[model samples]
Structures are given as C-alpha cells and as structure tokens.
Target: METLYRKYRPKRFSEIVGQKHVKTLFINSIKNNNVSHAYIFAGPRGTGKTTIARILSKSLNCENRKDAEPCNVCNSCISIDKGNFMDVLEIDAASNRGIDEIRKIRETVGYHTAQGKYKVYIIDEAHMLTREAFNALLKTLEEPPSNVVFILATTNPEKIPQTIISRCQVIDFKNIPLKDIVDRLEFVCQKEKFNATKDALIEIAKRANGGLRDALTILEQVAKSSKNNIDINDVRNTLGLVSEELIDNLLKNIKEGNIINILKIIDEVYYSGRDFETFLFQTIEKILLLIEENNNTEFINLLKPLSDILKDIKYSEEKIILVKLGFLNLINFKENNNKTTNKVLENIKKESEKIEENIESEKTEVMEKDIPKFDEVLEDLKINGDLSLYIGLSFAKIQEGSDKIKLIFPYSKKLHFELIKDKKSFLEQYIKRKFGITKEIEVILSNSTEDETLKKLSFLFGKNYKIEGD
Candidate 1:
C-alpha cells in the first residue's frame, strides 16, 4: 500500500504548503521566459525539493500550463505525476554517482527529446555524486543543449563543489511551520475519512519537527493503529513520548531542588525504553517554555549546559549513565547568576586553599582529635560474618571534627547509606569504641569527597559529572 505522504504529494505549485518564495521565483521565471538550463534545490529532507523538481518538469512539458502551474489533466502532467514520463529521467545519485554515469549523461545530452519539448534530468541526493562525476558533468552544465534541463536536489549543499554550484540557479527550502503542518494533517484526515482530535494532530505535527510529509505519514500510522479514533494518548504511546505531566513534575522537582526525585525519574524514563536523546531534547524544550513563563534565570542558565550535554549523549555507549550525570549536573548548578555552578565551585576551592595558606603562615594553633575509623568497623563486620554491611560501607568515609562525627558516602553509594543509616546504633557503637565519646553522628554526601569519587567514575563511565544532595 502507498504511504499517505506519497499518495497525497503535491502535484502543482499551488498544492505545495510552503516555500512561497521558491514558488514565486519559478512562476515569475516561467512567465518571463527566463527559465534556466540548470537549477539546484537545497534543503533538509522531506521539505519538497524533489517534489518541486518534478513539478517544474511537469509545468515545463505540460500541453497546457498557466503561470508555471501544470494542468493535471494534460498527458504530460499525468505521465510525470506517475513517474513514467519518457523525457523526464529521475536518477538516484547515491546509486549512480560514478564518472561512468556522468559520461552516459554527457553522451545523451546532445540527443533531442523523445516525447517532450525539453528533456529534464532530476538527480536526487546530488551531494552523493563523486568529485570526478561532478567534474565530468561540469562542461555540460557550463554550456548545455537548449533542449535539456537539469534539476539537482540535495539536503547537504555544502558537499557540492563551488564550481558546480556557480552554474545553476540555487533555491533554498525552509522547514514548514508547526501550525501549517497541523493544518495539512487535518486536511489529510478529512480526505481519508479518519477521525483525529486536534490535539492528536498537533502532537503528530510536533513529532514531525516541521516536516509535512512526516506528519502525514505519522497520521496514517496512528490511524491504522487506532482502528477507531486517534487521540493524544495514542500518539504518545506510538512515539514513546514522555508526557507533559512528567516533564512538569521534573520541572517542579528541579525548582524545589529535589535531586533524588530527579535521579529516580531519569532512571524510570530510561528503563521504560524511551529514546534518551529525544527525552533530553523534549526536556530542554520544556525547560525553555518554563523559562519564558516564570522568567527564571536558573532554568535559563541550566539550558545551555544541558543542550551541550545532550549533543554529546548521542555518542555515548551507556546513555542511561550519561543521562543520570546530565540531570545531576543541572541539579547541582548553584543559584549564583554571575558564574556557572562549576566556576563557583572552582572559586570556592581556591578561596579554601588561600585560607589554609594564611593559617599555615600565621602558625595558628591546631586541635588534635581521634577520627572514628571505618577499617575497624570493616574488620568487626568481617569477624562477625556481616559481609553485606562490610561491603556496603566499604566506600564510605568517617570524618571526625570538633564536637561531632560524620559518616560521608559518595553519591554512587546511595544504596549503602540507605542500608547503614538505618543501623545507626551499629555505627555509633564503633564510633564510641574508637573515640570513647558519644558525639552526635550524621550521615551525608561530602562535596569534596564526591569530587574525587566523580573523577574515578569518569574514568570508569567515560564522562565526569556531579550532583548536589545528601
């Protein structure tokens, strides 16, 4: 069965939804008898480069054409529409991009048209042509036969040599607007007799990313999948899209400085089989919208770093880990608007070092204290057959300061803290045995300790990152 995009493709300039500028130029040129022998159409894929090329061929060869519009009823128009026109040759440059093919085109360029007034050659993916192939076709393009027209279409115009580009009329295609794509989808639904909600169509359009053909194709898939009526939920399920509700919850968490919930949500989204890159992009999109409404500089500050990380996520072998790190970095960003979160930390570290230097230079008195040690606890656990507790506390650090003892763990050992924090008496008993005091005990994450831990994690996981939380 033909796809909706292929079946409903624009047959004339009037039917094209966008690119009014390109249409106007072609119409004026045809009306003025100023049609060029060679033309180049450059744009992103699914934006109607090849379609426009075919339309131009039909209009030029139509028995009846008005204002550069092809008469659909004419024999030339029908043949071109069906892709069976003898004088209209459609070549896939990706498949035939060698010097031999260009030579064959050169050989055939002098021959008169078999059926139409002017023979048209439409080369798709024109950027795929080899340098040698382009060199071979250069002479023909410089001074071609009057009875032939060449239409070169490509998504990446930068790949084409400047010399080849200089001899052709270049037209750039723009991405269709979201509203335009939605309207087109609605039109397709009415023609196909499919029931679709407005929001459902809008969601499809958003997923299409300003491609009309993609929107129509998604509409067809959703129509078939629904087997009754299409709704927003149907589109979400088909695309595995994270809901706006979920994104809002994420925003709320970030605003409230809830790092644990943010990390948990990332894990849930990753485990649910959502596309991580798409999730990051949609997350960035949602953040931008929130920044606009609330005028929050924090979100604005976090946006660029997250976007930069999102680009790097595509190359990651372990996407889930990178996603977790990316979110953590955002959560860890400080409230200071003057500097990025990382820079603030660097300044704080430098200040601390300066303070230490001053203390050393002044010969300040230092207090001595017995630090409650973890090695003794590990030995105790090993002696008592408590391997689970020993293993859990292996990565934890015990620091003793004036009037208090704190057990600090790296963020990566969150499960370990959960296990041992509940056994407060067990940890305190060891503290008393080592220090002979009942000082208050606190368990938490150490920023300085985590800095070192994250360095090791970077070595193990391929990226360095930090999150702020206890």
Candidate 2:
C-alpha cells in the first residue's frame, strides 16, 4: 500500500507546501518568461524540491498553463504525473552518477521536446553525480540548447562543485513549518477516512521535525497501530517516546533537591528503555527555562544544583578523567547509602538560606545608614551645585529603629514619585556605596507647609534660616 506522503505528494506548484518565497520567484519567472536555462533546488529532503521541479516542468510544457501553473487537464500534466512524459525527464542521479550518464544526457541535447516547446531534465540528488560526470555536464549547462532546460535538485548542495553552482540559478527550499505540516496531515486523515485528534496530528508533526515525509510515515504507522481514533497515548506508545508528564515530574524532583527521587525516576526511565541521553538533554532544556525566569532568583538558584548534578554524569570521554571522577563519586554514593548526598543537599539548603538572610541584612543596613545626617547629604548636593534640580529631588524620611526609609518631595507632583519608583534601585545602590550602608530605601511623595520645607532645608544645609508661613 502507498504511504500517505507518497500518495499525497504535491501534484502541482500550488500544492507544494512551504517555500512561499521560492514559489513566488518561480511564478514571477514563468509570468515574465524569464526562465533560466539551468536551475538548482537545494535544501533538506522532503521539503518539496523535486515536486516543485516537476510542477515547473509541467507548467512549461502544458498546452494551457495559467500564470505558470500546470493545467492538470492537459495531456502534458497527466503524462508528467505518470512519469511517462518524453519532454520531461526525471533522473535519479544517485543511480546514474557516472560520466557515461552525463554522456548519454549530452547525446540527447540534439533532440527537441517530442510534444512540447522545451525538454526539461530534472536530476534528483544531483550532488551524487561523480566529479567527472559534473565536469561532463558543466559545458552543456553553461550554454544549453535554447529548447532544453535543466533542473538539478539536491539535499546537500555543498557536495556539488562550485563551478556547477555558478552555472545555475539556485533556489533554496526550507523545512515546512509545524502548522503547515499539521494542516497537511489533517487533510490526509480526512481523505483517508481515518479518525485523528488535533493533538495527535500535532504530535506526529512535531515528531517529524519539519519533514513532511516523516510526518506522513508516522501517521501511517499510528493509523495501522490503532483501531479507532488516534490519541496522544497511542502516538507516544507507537513512537516509543517519553510523555511530557514524565519529563515534568523528573524536573520537579530535581528542582526540589530530592536527589534520591531524581535518581529513582532516572532508573525507572532507564529500565523502561527510555534513552538516558535524551533524558539528560531534556533536563538541560528545563533548567535553561528555569534560568530565564529572572524574577524568580530562588528558583534559578535551586535549579543550579540540579544542573550541576547533570553535568557530573559524564556522557562522553574526551574528558575521561572527569568522567572517572564522577563515576567514583557515584560508586561511593552507593556504598555510603546516600548519607553524603543528604549532607550535600543540606549544605545547599543552608547556603540558600544564608543568601536570603544576607540580602535582608544588607537591605536593613542600607535603610539605617543611607539617610545621611540631613546636613551632610544636603552639603554634598549643594557642592555638586544644583539647588533648582534638588528642589524637586525626593528625600526618603528615615524613622529611628525602622527598616523602611520613605521619600518626601513636595514641589514635584506624581512625576517625582514615578521617577523614584523607576530609579529606586539606582538610588539604593548610590546611597549604599555613598554611605557604606545596607538598608532598604522607600520613596514617598508628600506636600509639606512652606515653613516646614524651609526649616527642613535650613537644617539639611546646616545654615541658620527663618521661614515665613505661606
């Protein structure tokens, strides 16, 4: 039985999935009658390079083509689909990569298309052509007969000679997007009368990893494996892949610093035939995500120990000495009945607590000492010489024996409050460095009477001054 991907292979340019930019270029070339004599389509396999080449061939030969698209009703289109078209030749270079093959192709250049205006040569896996074969074809490619066109397709274009590349116009095809793959798979399911869930289709698509052929192959395998509607479990079981839930649980155990639990989960997975390397890779990925959440520093710190443990499990031996050390530690772990692991974990917890406490103590000290004897802070501001600028600058009112310091600025409205909020860190850092203190500073906006403002300013600047009430 034909597989879904092969059965539903795109029959025309419009049916080709992804490669929109390449499609546009092809369409415009056909529209403008500016087709190149030789072309190279290069990218990953199953990205529809050969399909597009065939479509372009049909469009060029069709008796009635519309906007460079093949008119499927035409005899040319039908014959091309059946691989019986004399005008369009599809050669598998992998099987015919000798100089003799190139010689045969060169010999055929004299004859024009039997039923069409041009003869098209589509060489699949053109990179497989031998060096001598490529050399034999280069001259023909450089100045091909007016009625002949060449379309060379390869997944590994780099293997082809640069001289050959320079002789042709290149179009790079890309891997199909996940959504496009899912949409196409859904269409296949509908056409085949097979029951499939959206999630099941998505899983198949993801497993394909941007290859439509792989996606279809997986879909076919799943359809045969299941009697009814395809479910997530069926897909997982069929693929022999681990569940996301298992991955999540493994991560949770690691994050909780439960080394025994993590090792148990690993053992379960390993014994169940899950790939240990894949588990390690997934754990690394989860740790990276945890690190990305900058607002949760505690979570980041917790994940660091897990990442360290993973790093110790040597998967390779270019660093064999380190791996030996890690294995020795693991062996010793078994002998000690996890006592060492428990002690290490306890130390980690104590370190985390110490870090938190240090932060709190620093905040307290900043609050206590950051508010200078109002006079000294005011003198520094004046020496820096900006009375007008300082007029609206906010000042945090410090209360004796309190951890909080509140800012007071009357001349400015809420703008000062907003600025203070935004610059709170900068202000705190500046105060700590300037005053050698470690306490939290809080900003508060308040309107004081004129007499109060003047008296405060005089006290702050250490100058005798009288204030008249407004």
**Per-model C-alpha lDDT, please?**
0.81, 0.74
Candidate 1: residue pairs that collide: none
TM-score of each: 0.70, 0.63
Q: What is candidate 1's lDDT per residue for 191-242, written digit by digit as tens?
A: 9888899999989988887788888888888888898499998998788888
Candidate number achieving the greatest TM-score relative to the actual structure: 1
